[model samples]
Target chain A: MNSEQQNATLRKMAQLMRDGLKTQTEPFPETEKEFAAILEELRRLDPGDLEGKMVISGFVDHPYGPDRQRCMECMYYLVHRQWCDLPELAVPVEADWWCRLWRI
Target chain B: MANLLWLQGGACSGNTMSFLNAEEPSACDLVTDFGINVLWHPSLGLELGENLQKMLLALTSGQMPLDIFVFEGTVVNAPNGTGEWNRFAGRPMRDWVTDLCKVANFVVAVGDCATWGGIPATAPNPTESEGLQFLKRDHGGYLGKDFKSKAGLPVINIPGCPAHPDWITQIVVAVATGRGGELSLDEFQRPKTFFTSFTQTGCTRNMHFAYKVSATEFGQRKGCLFYDLGCRGPMTHSPCNRILWNRQSSKTRAGMPCMGCTEPEFPFFDLAPGTVFKTQTVMGVPKDMPTGVDKTGYIKLTAAAKAASPRWAEEDIFVV
Candidate 1:
């Protein structure tokens, strides 16, 4: 997507989180198999189902744990693009935002 | 001339294919230039039946000098330790290996199989396969831990899935040229010269590795494979990047993760599901850290690197 399109999507996602979208933020995937299962769930979603993607992936607006794990430290995060680069969860995200699919 | 005898056990002859492709000091150069006498090789040997048996007998009985005995596969002792499962030249190959190793000046374990029982010795090993001097990380494989060649050195292991072509030939040349005593070996008995460096030492993607930008998929050309793709280059001890496979590229250079084939615990996690290409993590942190790095340091490094990563690191800078 172009810079304009990405910004619009980013704004929409930010607004949804701000409006208190109840995403699955508990039972964070602790292993690759669990993480893979979540990716499999994301794969079965409609391409445009952004809300479903956020819900299943356990997206949280703020850093989630004692270590405060977030998108900035995730291996799949593209820092400059403000995006999650994971193939299953390719979506715009703030650096402070997090999801269960996060890995360093 | 140095008499070199190459034998196969529970193997696929992949090492023989690799040895034939050696270029730095080609296989032909061993005979033509380095004065290595090819007594017999499974692929190159002309002798068959009684002739091969007679030659093997001569070497074992001390009638002929066996300068270098090169082994290419795991020593199989199956169906209750008789080694009949992998018979060769009228007897079990392991029997021949035992006899030849006792008299040979230098014994070289050529590939991962012979060095540390490669795939054949993995869990539920029906063949009861084992390496010359090691089984996985443990000492004492088919040969006892204290076993040594006539030269008083343990098996000089040149390990890889099919050890790099030059690694096999060059070490052969070293032993053939009577410089075998000068060779230093690691705890695993691999030549220190080749196994001292990590595969990540000279990698082109090192910049991306430093920036903590992971390549999420194969052949991505932009990021390092370590963080997401189960690359063992950081912990693997091999000069893969320095020596360069086929004189051009390595596994990581081609965007395939280094499988850590040279290390003893190869086929790591015993080929467990979802473990091959996917980095194993615990609580979202890498299960195996880079050599000498702890979890806290890795986590801190990742955060700093991600923040400091230049814009170009996230882009495909390798424009074709």
Candidate 2:
């Protein structure tokens, strides 16, 4: 997407999380099978269902867990674009954001 | 002229098909140019029935000089180890392999099956199949560890799902031309010339790998396959990228993950569910790190690589 569209979407995501979106951030997918199941749920959502995608993927604005794992180090995160490159969750995200699909 | 005999055990003839497709010193070149006398082969042999047994007996009985013995497929020893399960010519194939290895000057194992038992030797191996000199990572297989060819060398293993065509023909030519004694072998008895490098040595996606950009799906031009697609290129030893399959492309170049077929523990994890194409991770960290790399170092490197990755690294640069 263009820079303007990406920034607008990023603002929408930030606003949702700030308003207490209460996403399913616990029960982090421990294996590829579980991770794939989460992707499948996201795939079934409407293309514009931003909140549904966030809830299914367990996205949080801040880093999660003892290790403080975040999108910055995840293999799928595109740092320059500030995006998750995972085909199932191609969305704008902050470097500090944590998701159940996070992997190094 | 060097007398070469080719045999098959519990194999699918995949290696034979690959051997026939050899380009750099074609199978026909082995006969016409390299002076390798084709005594017998599963596909090209003219002998059949009693005639085939007569030729085999001649080689085993010291009546004819056996220069190079190339073996494809695993040595099957099932059904109470009598080897009655896979009989060729007149007796069991394993018995033939045993006798042939003793008489042959150089023994060359042509595929993963003949080198490390391949897929047949995976977990619950009912066929009781084993390679000539190895059963998976173990040292001894059907042949004892001390067993050597008449030339006093252990079985030279040219391993792959089906070994690269050029590797098979080139090694055969080297042995036929009396360079077999000069060949250097690794711990696994594989020729070091081909097995010394990783499949990622010349991969086109190395920039992506360095930048920690991952190709989440297959056939994507941008991003490396290792992070998400379970690519074994960084760990598996082979000249796949350096030599190039089909003289133009390799598995990694074509965007398919390297399956680590050259390693003894092939069909890794016994083809278990959810393990084939998906990178196995523990607590979001790769289970198998790049060769010689530690978990702490890998995490640190990933952080730095992502931070330094250029904007173009995230885009499809390989435009058709």
User: How do the residues B1-320 of candidate 2 rate in per-residue lDDT, one tens digit apiece?
Assistant: 99999999989999999999999899999999999999999999999999999999999999999999999999999988988999999899999999999899999998999999999999899999999999999988888889999999999999999899999999999999999999999999999999999999999999999999999898789999999999999999999998877799999999999999999999898998889988998878989999999999999999999999999999999987
Off by over 4 Å in 2: none
lDDT per residue, candidate 1, A39-58, as tens digits? 89999999789999999988
> Model 1: which docking level applies?
high
Give DockQ: model 1: 0.89
Off by over 4 Å in 1: none
User: For all candidates listed, what's the TM-score of chain B alone?
Assistant: 0.99, 0.99
- Candidate 2 has a TM-score of 0.97
Among the numbered candidates, top DockQ falls to: 1
TM-score of each: 0.99, 0.97
lDDT, residue A60, model 2: 93
Candidate 1: residue B161 lDDT (0-100): 93
For every prediction, compared with the true complex, DockQ reads: 0.89, 0.79
| Local distance difference test scores for all models | 0.93, 0.93
- Fnat per candidate, as a fraction, reads 0.88, 0.79
